[model samples]
Target: MRNNGAVHGAFRSAAMRFFSPRALAAPYVVWMAAFVVAPIVFVVIYAFTAGDGAFTVGNFAEMGRFVGVFARSFWLALISTAVCLALGYPAAYILARESGRVQRAAVVLIMLPMWMNFLLRTYAWMSILERNGLLNRLLGALGIAPLDIIYTPAAVVIGMVYNFLPFMVLPIYSVIAKIDRSLIEAAADLGAAPRAVFTRVIAPLSLPGVLSGVTMVFVPAVSTFVISKLLGGGKEILLGDLIEMQFRGAAYNPRLGSAISLVMMVIVIVFMYFMNRFGEGEEGVAIL
Candidate 1:
């Protein structure tokens, strides 16, 4: 009887420990350490060291040589993010007010494009944009001049906007869909005009979604190498291309690549900080 009692107590203790809150959180903690924390730590260590295993800051000094690359990437990403916001907001607003069937169709249309291989999607543009390709041939059929667009910065911008627009749309749609109909009704009951209703209530409520969308679109757009490479045709090297070259291209400087990665990460963090800081105002999206 004593032995059975002790066994029962031991089993209960194990069960209690296993069911603890900390136990449930352990997997998440391990995942965080393995993926997030470990990667950053490795980047930091590699970024601050030279090939000979000595500490150095020369990697950063070398990065200064590619200032134009950084600037170009930043400008391209900013423009793409802005364009996505312009195109996505109206689409999302319309979708938010749509019937269930229409809304699902719209969502499916947006996501369907993403289901294909990313490279294949980008390359498909090449066929449409290339000289004497479908677009040019279509223009020829209409007696319109065939325009040169492929392998240009404009092409790069188009790729960025096309690929990232859904990121902007989905977030805004989610926010607008959740907005209480009564709030809008209340605004209308106040004798406010449609423009006034939007400016006062709808826009402000959607600010967070816009901010999230911008971050989602901007980060990947800024870091994109494939889009710029295929579209820009290596004529213009952006920061991503630059960083990639450091590690894989002739330079083969992993330390420099790490430093640039670190700097880019810091820039993203700082930019997000300011965006979040500005967004925290109660008057967010509230026009004075």
Candidate 2:
């Protein structure tokens, strides 16, 4: 009887521990299972099945026709990520070296546009880039020719850089800001040149942030349909546009959409894995 009682007590204690408020992730796990996991499972099922629920590989085989679209998407996304990194890195480096007041003001200015509705911001850009828009009007006032920019790949890249630049800057700035001042001082004391101090110490220590920013920028830029539709004017049909068309546009092929999404998801996961491994290697080097 005592052994039975002890067993029951132990089981109850275990259950209580699992159910306790300290186990705060329990609800999150349940939510993820119902929403994220279940949706992914459905996507996988749809990707493999046909209209009549017959399994087929034709969906993937058909992807060969969209090679140009995939290439264009990756190219444009790469361009945007590169632009963001180029512009953001300098801004973040400068911002990190500024006074607290200047940093706060600069950060607010950088984030101001993000507070507006995304569509509204895009629309504003549309107007600004239009032939008779503010930018062209200013050029006209200066007796310069109006440049055609709207509905072009350049416009799409501009929109992407404007929207996602903050993502890159913030991560890099956060990492750079938290760097130990003592390490920098020590490097300088050891007669290291300014450039050498930056290259050997600050740059290496801040690589994880750069990787994070790249991931954040590249993933969304690669998969974005709206920027392509609104700015690219649907002339440059990208992978994102193709996937969206399958589900929402006249194509109405959910199976193909799911296949594209699944492929993109796997590619992104592999990319992230390499990025994380690279980050780990850099961290080890820094530690050494």
Candidate 3:
């Protein structure tokens, strides 16, 4: 009887597969419909409707003034992504080449700050870079004049790089760690120098990770309003601030906000498409 009961239980468990995927996915689909899809639908509806109960194109037609702000946001994000790549590539390489224990420790250290609040980290930079802050005091001890580092476009970039550097490092390290050492050895056997091996082998192999890191840093950096608000101090206006103003500030136009948000989304999608294309090219070269 006990043996029969055990068999019955196993059969029931095996038969539960149908419920598992559907049961687990149903709530997520409902949640997405309620949150993500609903909000986007609302935005689209708002973008097309006018305040006077008419469907009009005026909201989108007035997008010309916001174009310069979007351009500034793109370039600023590009600069921040470049800075993250410059710093993260060598760091990732070192982490990937290290021993197992060292690699684990380094990864932990790199990811440790993510557990902290992002706002706290940004404010910490404020403490270091502000006038009469720790940095200036250190410079004072050296008999050097205090430098103005905060409340400028440079400060905004610094904050962005600090916030997004780990995003760049982890993906690159993941790709670098998976790289086969035999490829490097093969390049050397073929009379390729270290530089040649790195350019032809390591760089090509790591393209997917590089593309991921660039997108991670660039997209958020361009659309972030908080960093600019805290660091740029109203002197610099990015697309995020402009969209935010349409919703929350004196403008108070949800339709315009929706239009701006849609445009920004389109820009991000286009940028990612190009990055993916570049990644595919590198993959093709590596295959050959």
Candidate 4:
């Protein structure tokens, strides 16, 4: 009986080794360490030290020179995020209230354009928004004056809104779609008006998704260079553009680039922190 028990214990140990959670996670862990963790470590090293490999804080100090770029980046990203929230919330609400077939069709339509490369999409906007481009010509045919919108800050915002709108919609829609119909009905039974129900119940419940959508929109918007580059006509420089210039352009300083990147990371973290704080009071948000 003792020998049988010993054999059974050994067999169970072998099975556990093969089927444990850690064994399933091993591939993802290795991939993350090699790609994500390693790159972050290198960026930190490059950001803090000088050419001689001596520790220095000058890299961060150097970012102080481009205060305008940082400010502009934040401002544009904030505006773009606001626009996406305003547009996306209504669209998502409508879609979520629709039949399942309609919801799937709408989501697929929104996601189809994203299948193309980002550069190609931005370039396509350039063709449409250019001075003598399709948009201007159409306006001219309608007896309206051609507006010089391309290569402007407005152009940058338009690019951001067009590109990142889906990010906001998908999250909010997912949240709204899963909201218990019973809750909405209960609010109605309690003599709650449509506006009051939405404000007190629907809006508060969807706050998590709103925060997530904001983070998704704002982070990338704040760090974008490609949209500013093609749309701003290489004149309007945002934080990302400055960082890229440091590493790749005439300014060619990888240390400065890394420092700017680190600063940008901190800024994004702070923004998300505030967003999370705002949503923390919600005791009734469901992930589904």
Can you write out model 4's per-residue Cα lDDT over 170-215, one digit (the tens) per residue? Answer: 8899888989999999998999999999998999888878878888
lDDT values of the candidates?
A: 0.90, 0.88, 0.88, 0.90
Poorest stretch of ten by lDDT in candidate 1:
279-288
Each prediction's TM-score against the native? 0.92, 0.89, 0.90, 0.92
CA displacement after TM-score superposition, residue 57 of candidate 1 (Å): 1.5
- Number of clashes found in candidate 3: 0
- For candidate 2, write residues 132-221 as lDDT tens digits: 999999999999999999889999999899888988998888788878999999999999999999998999888977898898899999
- The alpha-carbon lDDT assigned to residue 18 of candidate 1 equals 100
Off by over 4 Å in 1: 19-31, 281-288
TM-score, cand. 4 vs. native: 0.92
Q: Clash number for every model?
A: 0, 0, 0, 0
Q: List the RMSD of every prediction in angstroms.
A: 3.2, 3.8, 4.3, 2.6
